[model samples]
Target: MSERRYMISGGGTGGHIYPAIAIAEELKGRHPEAEFLFVGAKDKMEMTKVPEAGFEIEGLWISGIQRKLSLSNLMFPFKLMSSMLKARTLLKRFKPNVVVGTGGYASGPLLKMASILKIPTLIQEQNAYAGITNKWLAEEAQSICVAYEGMEQFFPKEKVVFTGNPIRKDLLEVRSKREAGLKHFQLDSNKKTVLIVGGSLGSQRINELIAGQLSWFEAENLQVLWQCGKLYYDRYAALETESVKVLKFISNMDLAYAVADVIISRAGAGAVSELSLVGKPVLFIPSPNVAEDHQTKNAKSIEDKEAAVMLREKDLDDKFEPVFKNLIQDIELQKKLSKNILTLAKPLATKAIADEVERLENAVR
Candidate 1:
């Protein structure tokens, strides 16, 4: 047999990029002789992140159409055309056995072109609500890997696979790192720790909410481990005390998860999946600004399962304190939330998705 070649495209955010990388890594492990290539939007983070993961990547001049009228929206047609031509060229040159797309605008043109060329394409949708790119490419894709249920409403039910989002391998063992995490963070072992992460870049609204509640947290005898994001670290730096450790970013997420008794986070599909593995009670503050308010949908799905709590940005000012107070005081609720969320975790998601890819490859052969 000839060497197997795979082309994967997903970008724009860490949620999409990480899952793409995870799937690629899993496939690489299985087929050590396989060649992998990643395609992402030219100016997007994946251009840097994909290569950082030790995979060669090609960038397409593509981006999502903005909701509001703007210069970029006007240029959308030309960009799409150019991207389609470039995608066709890449496909012809690479002749990949399988093309995988994790949701991002960059994947749209590439996957569509792959389908046109009669290549098997697999798309991974990471949100409870389908993304525009994934939705558009649904019919053409051979398999639709999804993290949420009821996704059949958006895609052909026969093609949808209930494979959860892929998470970093290191996070799987976070449960065993409590003692080491405590020592690393220099926190009192007796105090309950609250971990706040507002995604990679951090959410301004979440940062503000945390800032306003600092004194309240101290009064409740909770130690705060705040990842304020690189952009907002300077503004929140002076507020940090011995009990409140404010960091721009966390390099050791396993330790962070291990030390956390309660977690506050955004509801990106990737984060939700990781939090489920951590098995900690989580309060999700979904950003309302995302496409189709998908973040809210992501949080609501978990909340609906009684696996986690969802607090919208609009309700934060009125509901955050009461909701948080109730959650913190009720140990039973915390345990219930933790146990329920873990039930939603698919620790072997990367492998399962890879299995689907292999199936596609075998079917074509």
Candidate 2:
């Protein structure tokens, strides 16, 4: 029997990249002999992150269209044509049994080419609101896996699968790791620990909000485990004190989530999914700058269900103190948040996505 070959493409942000990695990791576990290839946009984080995750990746000369006219927009047509030609060459040479796209600039070209070639293709749409790339690919996609309900509004009903977003498998066992997490971060096991993550690159607004509220956190007797992100670490590292721990990034997120009694985070699709699985009380400050204002929508979906709280960037100055104070004091509210968020978790998402790929591959064969 010939070895199975798979191609996965998604990048630009951890939101897209991590899910693709999780699905690939799951597929690798199930089919150890499978040959894997990752296609990502050149100069995007995936070019580095994918290889670091132990996979061969090819970078395409592709980028997302800027909303406003720019020099990059002038080069769009040429880049698209070049990417498509390169994608054709890659597809013809590798002959993958299946192509999976998690949605990014690279995914648009690679998966579009795969569909044109009549290869089995699956797209994992992570956000509650679909991105332009995923929306464009929906018609040709064999399967459209999504994290939230009502995705049929964006894609064909028949092709949609409510598979949720793929998250780190280690997060699955957070319930038992609280002690280890506290020890790992060298924090008090007795004090309530609040973890703040603003994504890999960090959010400037979120960093500023946390900076202004250090005294409030101290007054509430909360210990802080802050991942200020690599982009703003130099600016925020000076704020670290005995009660607050600031880091460039939390390489061990499983431990960070484990130790967190409450979490303040940006409402990125990946963070929403991981926090759901972590089953902690979360206050989401959705980045206002995102396209389609999707982060607010992601936060709203959870907020609607009473699973978490959404604090808009504009409201931070007025609402942060009272909201944080009340949330910390209300043990019942914490219980409700934790229990409700856990109900939204799909821990087996990675396995389910890979299963969909296998099913599609078998049907085509």
Give, for candidate 1, the lowest lDDT window spanning 10 residues. Answer: 1-10
lDDT of 2 at 88: 94
Candidate 2 local accuracy as lDDT? 0.92
Tens-digit lDDT string for candidate 2 (1-365): 34699999999888889999999999999889999999999999999999998999999999988889999999999999999999999999899999999988999989999999999999999998999999989999999999999999999999999999999788888878888888899999779999999988888998998898888788878899998888899998989888899998787899999888889999999999999998999999999898899999999999999999889988999998899788888999999999999999999999999999999999978
Q: What TM-score would every model get versus the actual structure?
A: 0.95, 0.97
The reply for model 2, stretches above 4 Å from the true place, is: none
**For residues 1-365, what per-residue lDDT tens digits would candidate 1 score against the true structure?**
33799999988878889899999999888889999989999988889888988999999999888888999999999999999999999999999999999988789999999999999999999888898888889988999999888999999999999999988888988988999999999999999999999987788999999999999999999999999988899999999999999998886889999999999999998899899889999999998989889889889888999999999888999999999999999999999999999999999999899999999999988
- lDDT value, residue 59 of candidate 2: 93
Instruction: Give each model's clash number.
Output: 0, 0
Could you tell me the lDDT of residue 235 within candidate 1?
Answer: 97
Q: Rate the local accuracy (lDDT) of all candidates.
A: 0.92, 0.92
lDDT value, candidate 1, whole model: 0.92
Candidate 1, superposed: residue stretches over 4 Å from native: none
